[model samples]
Target chain A: DAPLFDRVAFIGIGLIGSSLARAVAHHNLARSTVCTAKDPEHLEVAHGLKLTTDTAPTIAEAVRDADLVVVCVPVGAYAEVAEQLKGNLKPGVILSDVGSTKTSTVRDLAPILPEGAHLVPGHPIAGTEHSGPAAGFAELFIDRWCILTPPPGTDPAAVEKVAALWRAIGSWIEVMEPEHHDKVLGITSHLPHLIAYTIVGTATDLEEDLKQEVIKFSASGFRDFTRIAASDPVMWRDVFLNNREAVLEIMQRFTEDLTALQRAIRRGEAETLEALFTRTRAIRRAIIDAKQA
Target chain B: DAPLFDRVAFIGIGLIGSSLARAVAHHNLARSTVCTAKDPEHLEVAHGLKLTTDTAPTIAEAVRDADLVVVCVPVGAYAEVAEQLKGNLKPGVILSDVGSTKTSTVRDLAPILPEGAHLVPGHPIAGTEHSGPAAGFAELFIDRWCILTPPPGTDPAAVEKVAALWRAIGSWIEVMEPEHHDKVLGITSHLPHLIAYTIVGTATDLEEDLKQEVIKFSASGFRDFTRIAASDPVMWRDVFLNNREAVLEIMQRFTEDLTALQRAIRRGEAETLEALFTRTRAIRRAIIDAKQA
Candidate 1:
């Protein structure tokens, strides 16, 4: 069968980008694919793995004749990348992304988009602590949710095209308003990553002896935080910076709740602790019932 | 071959208790085993699973004439259970426990220990979020750390016997001072559980719409915290209450660190965020190297 797009250009080939590239190739979602990265080593690794039909040395070169351009760089780097893609994108090209924060994606890429071009920003809610091109897999998005937040007035056909590609690659697509997307992910994704990074950072500052023992006995619970903290630093840093408002709001609630629990522990209020814990278990059950656990 | 212990009694056949009983039977570590629980349903489950040779209705009946008695109840119930075991233990009986807080174990079990009996408190660094007798398996302790915190001046023979039984069940034994064990676990286990429970509780308090969205997108990061938070509520409540000082101290350190990171995010201190994230990654590597991940 003919491919979905004549050509697909990936502006950055990291974990999510590389995974999508692999999936597109495996599922024949695109006729041909090309990827570019600021890091020359990543480009070489992408070439080594045959991640795409071609490797481009720059964003301009990658998106030169492509019908679709997916911005896969860190959110913090979007402005710089958008600057490069301003005059290079093909006419009527559909631009999309695989970023964690949607509001930031639109804020960064919308202004640079050409008049006839379509912008469909997507956030695939899936990943591991590992990063880089080699860390990606073709099945990473299988059965995962991929949310698209297109600015109002976007072409339905363009939005549907992007959704169809993700669906072909094995993702369940959900369309949401950008602001609501950021707020929901602030609690579900951003806040959890922040807390994990902070707790793991706390252990990093412990005295040498205690730190060693902490790692030795990490299987109990701390190991989970370490794994989350091990995710790409630049990607996460960009996420926090871009979603500051929503993240800070949820974090404020988290801190207040933590303080209450701390007080209960200090005062030996066993019932309060048990009550909150039991209530939280219901959330776990809900996640399981939703088949998201 | 003769069994390591002629008779072993299990006080409170819950998750840890039943696992130990199953391991004892599987490894032939004891010739005969008896278990008792304050919850009659738990006793019935123990009998149905054949977790022990016999199920006794009370602690006194369970420990009567047993050569070894392993306390597997929650830390909060230790003192009361100790009261019941005061005169029921056989002479030369080696008393042990599998509780989270080491200092509290020594404080509660040592006073009621028989004149010739030994007290060796243990905490196995392993478990799933599930609880109850049916949730346990014989291999729960395999390749896991079983920390034994015997009070100073405890009988050497008794300590060795307890250590040997754990070893026979495929556990690596680590001897530690009661105070030190609590301090180490305060950071590794208690503090993480508190953070998880707090974060999940925070989401539990969100508005109805957002709360459902949180569960739906939980696989991004929130699901992990949910699993940890889903752990037995009564058990964790007792943990925080019994390990108050150590938990509070570590929590103070964690809160201060979190506050600094929060400040950095507010100020858009990208360098600060990136540096801490990179450092935390090293700890994850160390854990992987230690084979703990």
Candidate 2:
């Protein structure tokens, strides 16, 4: 069978990008794949690992003739990358992304896209605490959700083709409005990372001796949060900045709930604390039952 | 090669208690072990698993003529258990516990101990989210820290024997003041669990449709918090109530830090968020370096 696309270009080859490249090559989804990153070392790593057929130092060089261009950088850098991509994209190129925040993806990339080029923003709900090109694997997207938020009246054929790319890489496809995607992920992914970052930052601010002891005894429960908190700082920062309203709304609810629990603990309200804690366990069971645990 | 104690009694055989019992049996740490729980089903499960040499109906019966008595109930139940144990402990018997909060262990158990009996409170820094006797295994304590918080002037021989028992079960031992133990754990274990419980509780409060979606996409980061939140509720409620002071202190620090991050996010202060997140990574690296990750 013919490959899904003749050529695919990745604008920033980090964890998700490199992983997608690996999967693309493994599945023969593209006949030729090229990637570019601002960091020379990351490009070198991608080249050494053969994550792409060719590597370029600039997005212009990478996407000049590519049929598909997937932007895989921090949301904060999207605008700049979009500028570089504006004049370089081939007519009828399908532009997609693997960024965390989708509304911002549309807000930043859609304006600069060339006429006749389709914009289909996406987010793959998969990754580990580790980052960088070397941390990628061909199976990274297996059984994970890859959400695409295409603007209204966009070409269905273009969306289907993008969905096919993710499908070829083993992702279950979901198409949603960009705004709803941001809201759902605000609760699922963004808020959780924010809380993990806050708790790990709290541990970091402890006195020197106590800080060392925390690391020594981290396996208790803190270790999990530490792993979540160790995710790319720049990536997370951009996520918060780009998705401020949704993140803040969810965070406010979380803070209020936390405050109520704090008061219950202070008042020795065992039943109240027990009720909330017990109810939360049901969700965990549901997650396990859903095969997402 | 002989057992450390002639007879060991467990006042409540839940997850931690049963795991210790299994480790003791596997290593022959005790010549005879007897357990009793307020819940008869737990006793039945313990018996079915052959976790102890004997099962008794009451604390009085369980502790009779035992050389070592370990209280393994919720921290909130410590005072009631102490009242029941007031006259049951034999002379020169070593009294201990595996409670999360050490200061409360001493405050509750010390007042009721008979003369010449020793008290050594310990907290093993290991456990999964699951609870109950069925969730225990002998390898639970391997390579983990078993912190002992014995009061001043306590019998050195009793402390040495308890440490030996843990050592035999492959635990590394660290002796410290109970207050200090609570403080360190307030940061490392309690706060993390509290945060996890809070965030998962927030998810539980969401609209039904959104809640289901959150679980489906949880692997993005929320799944980790759900696992922590799934931990036994009564045990955690008791932990927060008993360790109120230390937990509140650390939680206050955490809230301030969280609020700062929240403000930064609200203001779109990318640098502030990035700086704190990057600093937290150092702790994760340290935890990995310490072999506790």
Candidate 3:
């Protein structure tokens, strides 16, 4: 059978980038896959792992003849990378990204897209705490959600092709507006990461001996936060920076809720605490029922 | 291969209570074990699961003729249960508990203990989100820590007997002052659970459509918090209420740290965010090195 695309170009070769590359290779979704990264070491490691069919030193060279160009770098770098690819994209090429924040995707890349090029921003809601090109695998997207936020007026064929590629790679797809996607993920992913980072950072500031004991006894709960907080710093920094309003909005709600619980604790309002705790358990049940647990 | 105790009495038969009964039966730690709970259904489930040698309708009856008694109910119920055990405890009996808050355990339980009956409060740092008697297994305590916080002037022999039972069941033992245990666990367990409940509660307050979407995309990061927040409500309520001083102290630190991160995000201080995230990763590595990851 003919492949989905003549060639697919990846603009970054880190965990998400390399994982998609592996999935494309495993399913033969594209005739050829090429990747480029600003970091020379990342390109070297991706080549060593054979993550892509070819490697390029620049985004312009990588997307030269490709029909699909997926920008998989951190959201903060989207503007700079888009500048490099402004007029070099092939005619009728589809431009997509695997960035966490979709609003920023359209904000930064949409302006630089050449004539006839379509943009379909996506977020594969899957990953481990590990990073780098060597930390990726073909099965990372299995049974996971691939949310695409293609702007209005985007070519339907372009959206369908991106959906098909993700479907072939083991992802379930949902399409929504970029603004709504950012808000939903702000609660589900970005805020959770921020809270984890904050809590773990709080523990990191504990006195020396107490800090050692915290690590030894982390299985109680702190260990889980540690895993989430250990995710790629550069990527998360970009996520918080680009998705500022949504994150701050959700964070405001979280802080308000936390303060309420703290006040309940202070006033010895056991009923209030128990009621809130029990109410939250229903969400967990709902998540389990949704098979997201 | 004689049993370690003539008879053992459990004041409650929830997750922790039933698991301890199963472990005692597995290791022949006691010749016979009896349990009683306020909820009749819990007693029925414990009996059906064969978790205890006998099920009593009341705490007073359960502790009759038993040489060792372990209170395993929520911390909020400690005072009420202690009232039932008072004046009924056998002379020279060793009394202990599996509650999460040690200072409260000592505070609530010490006053009711009869002369010649020794108190050795312990907190087994192990559990799952699931509760109830049927949710227990004999191996739940394997390779976990069981911390004993015996009050000053507690009988050394009584503490040793309790330590021996835990050792036979494959737990590493640590003895510390009750205040110290509360402070350590406030950071490691209580604060984490509070933060999780807060985050999950924030999601719960969202609009219905967005709430459903949060569940669908939970695998990103929110799922872990859901699991933590799903833990027994009454138990956590008591933990926060009874350990208010320690919990509030640690939560203050956490809130301050979180606010700092929030400001950094608002200001687009990528270096500050990245530095904090990088420092937290070292703690994860330390946890892994300690084999607690």
Candidate 4:
């Protein structure tokens, strides 16, 4: 594989950031790599892990003279990142992001980007329940999907370079509108996490005796939701906050559907319950057949 | 390990049944083992895998001379299984079941059991998502809890024998009243699966275009719920049907709590949402500390 960039800078080195940093280093995607994270301990761990060739104390310092700049921070941090990278980015530098939401990212970062710096919003639909720099690995993106949402009329070469880098890291690429991507992910990802967090939260509020039993016997099914809910709370809070409209819209639909289900269970409508239960099994089969299982 | 039973017969050969069969076989807990299933194909698979020493053509044949009989079919078939085993079971045979719910099992089979035979209802709190004879592994029960609910003032030797059998199969045993076990499991297992099945079903009803996208991007969180919802429907149907009171009771609490959370989200009550989410995370940490993670 050829080096995609002579120099690349990372704005935040969290789970996704560190993972991509490791992947870039492993694949030699860039000749020189640098990163800056807000948290001091995280930066220390990233340095210790050798996530990039150099660690910068400031975002502007990190992007100086870099041919590529990747903003791998929480969606809420996009404006701050773009502010720091404003005049420091090299001419013709491709500015990209690995955020969970895209519309807000484009809206937040595009305004602050300097002339000759390209903006390409992206989301790698891969993550574990864990977070932090030390929890990352090069294989995190293997066989996963990386979606790019490039504004129309954006330079095609900049898009291709990012796509190629992701492909080299074992991801398949798709270009889509930011709005469509958010809506699609709202139902598949956002709503599910909200529900898991809600149900597990419900169990937590149970009477003390029942609560103890819930943990003791969690292996049944509740435990899986707990694992998902155990994911980094601040990161998730940022996700829900940045993608508010889409997440709220899908959460509405989920609540209505859940209400219907609750009524069915209350009414002992076994047929409706079983029919829905049986139909959903086919999707799991489809997922297995699609090799995503 | 000492032989726990003179003879033991498994009535169905699937993931749970075959795992128990393998454990019993590996540990020499039973001198002879036999199995039969409603589906002839499963029998063929069991026979091909050599799951039991004698693969009987009928349930009656399998239990005719056995010292212990375990009904391993999906809970929906419990009544039929009890009917079949009633007349054929030996006078002193200890009859038990490996089901998700105990209250209903006692209700369905206790009345049908022969007058002199001992009933020591048991449930091994262990399993993987996979099913079928091929999915069976001998170590599935290791370090897991197995709950037994024997009726008031039944034979102590019968309960001890069943506990010994589970111990031989590498499970820690606990004895509880039927109602308490039902209530505890309702909060732990049944409610979680029901919620998972409902949410995954909710996603399946999305528009065709969005449905495909849901599957494509499911790695976020929905995928876990799908896997849990894909579990055997018949077995779950029986679980709900059998543990109706406790399941319904806890489900009421869950629905109410869910409604509260939904209201909180809609009202943008971030503090409430964050607090509940934080508490749940603490519970997750507890589970990890307990070595159940």
3 against 4, candidate with superior DockQ: 3
Give me candidate 4's TM-score against the actual structure: 0.95
User: For residues A178-202, what per-residue lDDT tens digits would candidate 2 score against the true structure?
Assistant: 8998899999999999988888888
Q: Which interface RMSD values do the candidates have, in the order shown?
A: 0.6, 0.8, 0.6, 1.6
Candidate 4: share of reference interface contacts reproduced: 0.57
**What is the TM-score (0 to 1) of chain A in model 3?**
0.98
lDDT of 2 at A228: 90
- The true-versus-predicted C-alpha distance at residue A77 of model 2, in Å, is 0.8
In model 4 chain B, where is the ten-residue run with the lowest total lDDT?
B261-270
Candidate 1 local lDDT, A1-293, one digit each (tens): 88999999999998989999999999998888999999898799999999999999989999998999998888999999999998999999999999999898999899999989999999999999988899999999988999999999999999999999999999999999999999999999999999999999989999999999999888888998888989889999999999999999888998999999889999989889989989999999999998887
lDDT of 1 by residue, B1-293 (tens): 88999999999888899999999999898889999999898788789989999989989999997999999988999989989998888998989999999998998988887778888889999998999999999998888899999888988898999999999999899999999999999999999999999999999998999898898899899999999999999999999999999999999999999899899999999999999889889999999998888
Best by lDDT: 3
Residues A1-293 of candidate 4: C-alpha lDDT, one tens digit per residue? 45879989989888899999999999989999999899888889889988899999998889887888889887767777777777777778888999988888889888877787789888998999888888889999999999999988889999998999999999999899999998888887877888788778778877888788778777777788899998877667667766678887877776677678767767777787778778879999988877678
lDDT for model 4: 0.84
Ranking by lDDT: 3, 1, 2, 4
Off by over 4 Å in 2: none
Q: Quick one: how many clashes does candidate 3 have?
A: 0
How many angstroms is residue A194 displaced in model 1 relative to the true structure, after the best TM-score fit?
0.9
Per-candidate DockQ versus the true complex? 0.89, 0.88, 0.88, 0.62
Candidate 4, residues B170-228, lDDT tens digits: the string is: 88888999899998888778888888887788788889888988888888888898999
Indicate the docking level reached by candidate 2: high
Q: What does candidate 3's lDDT look like per residue over B1-293, in tens digits?
A: 88999999999988899999999999988888999989898788888888889999999999988999999999999989989998889988999999999999999999988988899999998899999898888898888899999999998999999999999998989999999999999999999999999999999988998999999999999999999999999999989988899999999999999899999999989999989989999999999997777
